[model samples]
Target: MNFFKPVAAVALGAALSASTAITAFAADTTLVISSWAPPTHGMNAKMWPKLTKMIEEATEGRVTAEIKYKLAPPPAQFDLIQDGAADLTWIFHGYNPGRFVATQLIELPGYQGSAEAASVAYWRAYEKYLKSANEHRGVKLVALHTHGPGQLHSSTKVTELDQIKGMKLRLGGGVSGAVGDALGATGIRVPAPKVYETLASNAADGVMMPMEGKKGFKLTEVAQHSYVMPGGFYRGSFALIMNQEKFESLSKADQDALMTVFGEPASRMAGQVWDEIDAIGVEATESTADNSLNTASEADRKAYDAIAAPIIEAAIKAATDKGVDAKAAVEFIASDMAAN
Candidate 1:
């Protein structure tokens, strides 16, 4: 009878273990992510995949997310998340223009750093300063990040900055629009997915984008020449946001674990992905027959500095009106980038 009891206890323990495993599996929830970028883009391929893994691991399989492409357009992502049509998504602050004045604080030119550093800075500054602006109201913000420095890409070689004066360039909204105006280029506004066609059709002579465009947007195939300044013409601000209701639906433990993995950790991961893709893009451009990357002359850089002063002042005034200490935030971002 004692021997029979021992065997029954062992069988009972095994059954309990299996039941627990089943319960855990049943508790797992998949969050849908809306992505507008090409499936192969760094954000989709690297950033989201890594973030999803982090979520699954941190939540112990309690929660996860998968990217669903073409679920909505880039500009519509925020609303999609807000309405719970998608549980999570990323948005370019620039694409919405004046709607997010504080976000432009990171988009300003002449920031010295890699996307990783800038992104880390962007998140800290957003948390410490821009969060009060309430710019991203409907969604639960997960992280803030910026792309690498924006540079010029053209079909025709531009040896001198002045050579771009009359050319038509595709500006990716935000400060890129201002930079294009400063350079006296006619601005052609289009979503990023349309950039290659804009160049191919001769509708735009160039585009202002980060180094990743060489591959991400396949610009090296259409625009063969690149001109970059010391700091950068502009930076694109982006945010990973989740539906507020969806976030609130999580188990408290899962919510707390997700909170830890997001913010700076998520931002830095995304920034690293941008830096990686930029390196890949540069290598791809190097292999292309006529593609080249050129550093602007010091004289041109100085000229750009002069042109930027007014835009910077204008941005500060706008942010100040929004009750943000824009100057201090800019300084903080610079310092944060430097420190990290």
Candidate 2:
């Protein structure tokens, strides 16, 4: 009987240890999400959390992600994901210059809708037309999105379209850089994180970005003069990417579940976050003293429309050169966004 008691005690201890190990195994993977934005930014505070939650739920809590800040610079995000330095990251197509040409299609001005509509259309366009380019060859492209209407934010008030000429403005590249050139502004290349410092130092007179910048980047403190253009001057293109090898390492079941949450669903979710933060930015701008909200006059709007026409045509030609039906893609996006 005493020998039996010893055997039973040993079995009980083994069971308890196994249970502990099983609990640890439930949280098997922690994806490192390398982000360059400030923690307070909507991208960091809301968008990443939402994405992580989706991933966790899809995989039944088997896979989770944690945000890691400043692991690399903004322009290096794509390479980071490709090199597997990080499991996931978001990238601005404009930041890498010639690395992404097809993405400029979404950045072209005059898309009439919220970021959510445009982003959903963007995902569809990527699957139908843009995927052929193979621009994102090494990394797994999870989602594509664009910010709300990009407009002019300045230190000094700019009332007319012509006033932009010769002013030094921070341009995030791609079509925004082209827009700056079209407006005769001396384009200053800087990442969004540097925008506040650039404007505060007077190195840049203004920046072209979404209204979210007011709250997201503290632009309300530096660039108080807002020259709002109807339909916005441009839109910024962004992509969520994951390390290909890391994604492949997941169980087939988990991988398939994650795919269900990726692409259009994730893109729409990101765009909705942008819309929410953009509203916050607008509220911050209006509430702050000495901040001026100047909408573009009818004549100025007409002038901008004329200026944007050639830029749009030029972008189409660029995509066409890459073996894509650029015109059809753009038209589809427009119709889809309008309907959305």
Candidate 3:
């Protein structure tokens, strides 16, 4: 009876080990990541490749990430990720304004000082404050980041608040359009691809985009004058997200490895890279004939902020209507930026 018991125990242990091995093998899987850039943009050129390499090596090739570039334009990235057309992709929250009302807290004016700091703060806030609700119900948020300070690039020079008045400015999304309205410019919502043609044809006089836009979209060729404000009027927010179903299907080990590469450190690295690329864009723009850069005066900045403040206040009120404690969130972001 003792011999039979020992053999039974050994067989049971072997079966358990084999089951575990099979489960682990089944969990080892590959995920597809897509992006709007053509693998030449700064996000693709500097960050994604490094992240993919880290993910693959960390998982010992058990988990692989395949990047498909230029799968769609910027506006389509969110839907692509959400619908599982892509397992993971970057999303510009500002592109779909009403879709992400809570995350829009990050886009408010005067809250973020630098992209690195802001990106870190945004992730912290989302995890600590925003995620409790059903804000991002159907997706796994990998990172939240933003570009450097958004500025004005124009065909003609804009030296003051008055100069921007009545100018047709090609702005990216609702937040920028609000900034344009505050500055009294006629905001035109055009895709980034169409910006150069629009400016060249006199369809738009200027654009409110990151400084990098000058080089990325070749806006420098057509719009030679860049009007930089003292501080950013507003910055846009973006997300790296995975489909919920896709994320759940990953092994626990692979999930942990992916999360390790995301969060505040990754966002800070991304923001710094964007800032460096923005400087390069500025240099490239400056190298062109007839291109120039100028900073607005204190008084001009004050005038512009005055207009922006009211718009921001109205946004807060609107957010309050949606059950968010907008005032507290705004105050917290402001205090955090000031302290940091």
Candidate 4:
């Protein structure tokens, strides 16, 4: 019996060691990233690449990611990931409308900041306040971010605040639609990819998008004019998310390492790409002869301030009704940007 006891203990120890090795090897290390943006878009070209490298380094080769296009349309990305059709993806909150109201807090006009600041602040706000809403329940929220200020890109030059009235502007949803309604512009609903064709075919007068559209969506070719407001008409909010079950399947050690590179750090990475691309888009539009860029005059800005008041109130009401402290979130975002 004594000899059997030592033999049994040795066998148990060896089996436990083998089990640990198998568990380490069983972690699903490679993530499939589903993307809806154009292949050349910064979200693909710059943002995804940096994030992939971060995953690789932090996981010490235990995990990796790859980008796949056309897995689903922009709006369906969340469901696609949730259903395990894809392992990871980014979502535009505006595209889903009723399904995502809390995200609109970042979309409200006049948040004075760069994309990076807003993105960082957004993550903080999500953790502190937005999480209670449970807006992103199925997917594991990795980061929250925003694009550069959205402006009017049109076939005709628009400089004054009132010039936007009666223009057939392609509204990309969220607060941009609210801004269009406020300006009394006819809203033509379309996806970002369709904006070029919408303008080229004269189906719409212009589009509400960030300066990056000049390069990313080739707006300079169709929409020769850019009407920029003091703080932008509105900003668009986005989220980087992963399939929850997929995330949970990873080894605890690998999961811990991945967490270190997620959230605010990841948001800043994606937002910085937006800022860089916006600068490039600005240069690209100005460098082209036929393209025109116009900034609202001081009087026009004051008029815009007046126009924005009601829209702001509606946005706050919408958010507050959903149990978010819209005023506090807005003020926090502004202060975060100022601090940065």
lDDT score, candidate 1: 0.89
Per-residue alpha-carbon lDDT of candidate 3 for residues 214-236, written as tens digits (9 for 90 to 100): 88778788888988885576787
Distance from true location, Cα of 108 in model 3, Å: 2.2
Local distance difference test values of all predictions, in order: 0.89, 0.95, 0.77, 0.89
Worst 10 residues of 2 by lDDT: 19-28
Question: lDDT, candidate 3, residue 101?
Answer: 70
Model 4 C-alpha lDDT per residue in residues 179-298, reported as the tens digit of each score = 999999999988887788888999998899999999999988999899988679999999999999998999899889989999999999999999999998999899999998898899
Candidate 3 lDDT for residue 205 = 91
Please tell me which model should have the higher lDDT, number 3 or number 4. 4
Query: Which candidate has the top score in TM-score?
Result: 2
Model 2 per-residue lDDT tens digits across residues 186-240:
9999899999999999999999999999999999989998999988999999999
- Which structure is stronger by TM-score: 2 or 4? 2
Clashing pairs in 1: none
lDDT of 1 at 305: 91
Pull out the clashing pairs in model 3.
none
| TM-score of each model, in listed order | 0.92, 0.93, 0.86, 0.91
Q: Candidate 1 has what TM-score?
A: 0.92
Q: How close is candidate 3 to the true structure, as a TM-score?
A: 0.86
For model 1, the stretches where C-alpha displacement exceeds 4 angstroms are 1-27
Tens digits of per-residue lDDT for model 1, 23-66: 65654789999998899998899999999988988988888777
